[model samples]
Target chain A: MIQLNLHKTLSSTGGKMALDLDLTIEKGHFVTLFGESGAGKTSTLRMLSGLLKPDSGMITVGGTTWFDSRSNIDLKPQQRKVGYVFQDYALFPNMNVRQNLEYALQKNQDNSIIRELLEFAELEELQHRKPETLSGGQKQRVALSRALVQRPEILILDEPLSALDLKMRIKLQEYLLQVHKKYKLTTILVSHDIGEIVKLSDSVFEIQNGRVIKNGTAADFFGLNKTSAKFRFSGEILKIQREDVIYIISVLIGNDIIRVVSDPKEAALLRIGDQVLVASKAFNPIIQKL
Target chain B: MSIVCVEVDNGEELMSVVIDSPESAPYLKKGKKVNVLFKEMEVAVTTQKELNISIENRISGVVASVEMGLLLSRLILETNIGEVIAIISTKSLKQMELVERIEVVIMVKLNEIILAP
Candidate 1:
């Protein structure tokens, strides 16, 4: 388990603000820090990673004391076994992919772990490629692989996929899940995207003005209550065509169009340019690949 | 009974039957329209190469996004029928290897469709 009750003062462009956070996270769970800019999400991560010292409070992980203001005990960033993947790829321009990962290894550590990580990250084919030649996704993959070389108990991801496009972001989300499960690591992520937060996190802490304002599961934050049997979307009716006893109705939702079939009696009530919502119940909807 | 026809993307069309009642008369009177609603839990997604089912409402589209919850995953598909959201088991998601832009079919029964003015 990870426990933190930290207080810090941050100086931002707006002014100085106090950041007070208290959180406890179970092991092998994915937790996210969600909020707006300068909401102290990054500050909380920095404090946990030992990059920033807190003004007061205690931080304990799995019975190990990383910080305690009363005793003035603090561990250096290097002393904490944390795997941090920053927003930027942070790959050494001069080093190749394999070398970048090798540099993160502790002295006297076995070199075989590098091979395992390369395979796990699917970077084996690009092992000798330089960071300059790699795509944004590839660079981020390299950064992720390098961070795991130490087999750290805790994994920190700071918007690692923010630079990628939607397609790439989806791909990396899968990889991140694989790595997190394989290592059984306590993962903490910072993100602003609601979809990403819902897809990746087991729990979320909403931060505001450097204080934790709310904590809950993704469903709670997304308001995905399961008791209801109704779904709705608004669209403009585009066309109405007659086919035998049924009328084929067309509606435009955003840039896409949906076709609906209705009885003649019901069709008589609708016309082109009409706005309507198509709702459905909890009946089974089959999904098949094309 | 009132029927509303909707045209989604790719020229595909769908129809919804709106049961006339005092509460729905104003919204369905003649011109005003609003968003569509369906139970979020009623939607299901699959990544199989082919599907054989009796559900009459079948639309094909690329996956727009996937939101994974503890037990369920919310999938948004950009089909010719528009962007439809479905919730499925996480186990099935991993088993089918469903990801963005992968073509899949979404099926909904006709009777379950509700129309809001």
Candidate 2:
């Protein structure tokens, strides 16, 4: 498990915030820190990885104490086996892609693993390409591969896809999703994009004004489903279609068709045009009633 | 049986609701009246706050140019409202229909505005 309970402040000219956070992410779970700009998502990530020292609190990752202010235990960044990927695919300008991955691995580890990571990250063709030569998406892939090459227990990604274009962001998001599934990594991502958080996160922590206001499953937070006390629009069901075991129904609201997923058995009870209600809540993504 | 506009943000055209319920559910056989409820009911104050702030109600502009950068996306939206530039994220660009002379919706939250002394 990765546990962090720390308070830190950033005192830059334009940015200043006192962040007090206490979060525990289960092993192999993807926890996304979501908020607006200056919400302290990046600061929290930096504190966890020992990149920034917290004012006070305990942070233990994978049973190792990364920072414990009371005990005065603060491990160095390199001492913690953490893969940190910044928004800018910070590949060394001096080294090629192969060398980048090579540097990530330990001196005693096999070279074949680097080749495998290159293949998995789909950078096999651009092994010799420098950071400047590769496209934005390609550079992101290389950065992700480089981080994973060391097989770190915890992966800390700070807006990894935020730098890319719209199309590139989606592509890299899917790629990262696949990588997480394959490795079951305990990943922490900081992003302002709600769609990205919805697509990639299992759990979402809503940070506003340097504090976590809400914490819930991604589905609940996005309003995809799971009930909450928020403004909800309930529409009438238009049609129901059967797709294998699932019954998909469309609810009509002012020419808009909202689709809801339900069990086939319950769907069978309703006629071809039975009246069903679709509930969509405010502050959560639109969800069709089950 | 009626849906009324409760709050008007951009010139009464773009707004939210205080709907009593639709006259009828068009597609469904069974329909019932929905009691419109305010999402924020715990507020102490009953009166609404209206402040006189210079807001860009509308903007009429061309794409002018699309500056796609690492952090921010600046869209020079030229409209009859005004040739105002808006900064949005790249992820939000997918949802935007940026065309020449397109009327875009610009929402200004009251909390974001700093009250001058």
Candidate 3:
């Protein structure tokens, strides 16, 4: 479990922002901090990783006290076993993929972890390739693997996929999930993209002005059923039949064809191929259990 | 009931809809000219060719644009009927592989249809 009650004062050329936050995250939970730029999302991550010291308050992860301002107990960055991935990937241009992973190892550590990470990230084929020769996606994989070489208890990713294209971003999301599950690492991601938050996070904390304003599961924020009392579903228009002035429109909704009655004037506006929404607030929609 | 004229791009006759007043149904006889309206939230979008639900309003159109947000994506489609907008999850957008010009189906519940004469 991770427990934090941190207070910090930040001053940039823009102005001063106070960051006062209290949060407790369960172990192995994929949590995301979502906010706009300069909202202190990255500051929170840096504080957790011991790269930034809090002005006041405590931060404890898995019973290991990383910070306590009152007692002046602050652990060094290297002392905190955290795996961090930055947006630029920060891979060494001079080193090959295998060398990069090996360099992150502690003194007297075995090289077996390097081989394991290379296989886990599917970079064994390109292990000898330098960072300059690798693609953007490949460099990110190396960075991720290098971070994991330490077997960190906490994994922090600050917009790691922001630089990649949509296709590569999707692929890396899967990889991140796999590594988080396999290693049982407590992962914290900073993202502005709602889609990425929903796709990966178990819970999301919405930050505004350097403070956490809302917290909930992805479903709570985006579930369709939560939006209304009326019945809703997506389907396609299949056929339109005219009987006198009333038009019957056939809609295919998941293998079921439903016919709706409409007036000729209203029906005239709809084509056979037009995507339309069917809704009614008058009656209670029946729910059948299969 | 509120009546509004909808202009279609294909030069079809102007479409009118009566909205919010269901009591106007009795006066809406055959061949009667009336306007139709439905709540925006009542609309849903899907890429599936077939669905098993009992919804009545189903229309297909080509995707015109998709505005992706952190949680919801606004999709606009141009169909023969008119331009329809849908707000769905970004996850669904990706899973459906919905992009500009892709054909999709829009569904709405029957009772949610509001008419104004």
Candidate 2: clashing pairs of residues: A222-A285, B58-B81, B59-B79, B60-B78, B60-B79, B60-B80, B61-B78, B61-B79
Instruction: For every candidate, give the share of true A-B contacts it also has.
Output: 0.12, 0.00, 0.15
Please give, for residues A1-290, the per-residue lDDT of candidate 3 as tens digits.
99989899988668999999888889999999887788888888899889998999999998988999988899998889899999999999899999999999999888899999999899999999999998899999999999999889899999999899867887899999999999999999998655677778999888877788988886454442232223544445789997533467897654467887664547789888565556544354576799
Q: Give the per-residue lDDT of model 2 (tens digit) for A1-290.
A: 98889888778567687888889899999889988778788888888878889999999987888889998999988788788999888899889999888988877888888888889987888999788998989888888999988788888899898778767787788888888888788889887666677678899998876688999997667654433223434344678886533557886543367777654445677765443434433333556889
**Cα lDDT computed for each candidate against the true fold:** 0.79, 0.66, 0.77
On TM-score, the candidate that comes out on top is 1
- Candidate structures ordered by lDDT, highest first: 1, 3, 2
| Chain A TM-scores of all predicted models | 0.82, 0.76, 0.79
DockQ per model, Cα: 0.06, 0.01, 0.08
lDDT by residue (B23-64, candidate 3, tens digit) is 634544545554455544356888786999876567777899
**RMSD, one per candidate, in order:** 17.1, 19.1, 15.9
iRMSD of all candidate structures: 13.9, 15.9, 14.0
Model 3 chain B poorest ten-residue lDDT run? B13-22
* Candidate 2 Cα deviation (angstroms), residue A109: 2.8
Once model 1 is optimally superposed onto the true structure by TM-score, how far is the C-alpha of residue B37 displaced, in angstroms?
Answer: 7.5
DockQ for candidate 3, please give it.
0.08
What is the TM-score of each predicted model, taking all chains together?
Answer: 0.62, 0.57, 0.60
Question: How does the DockQ of candidate 2 come out?
Answer: 0.01
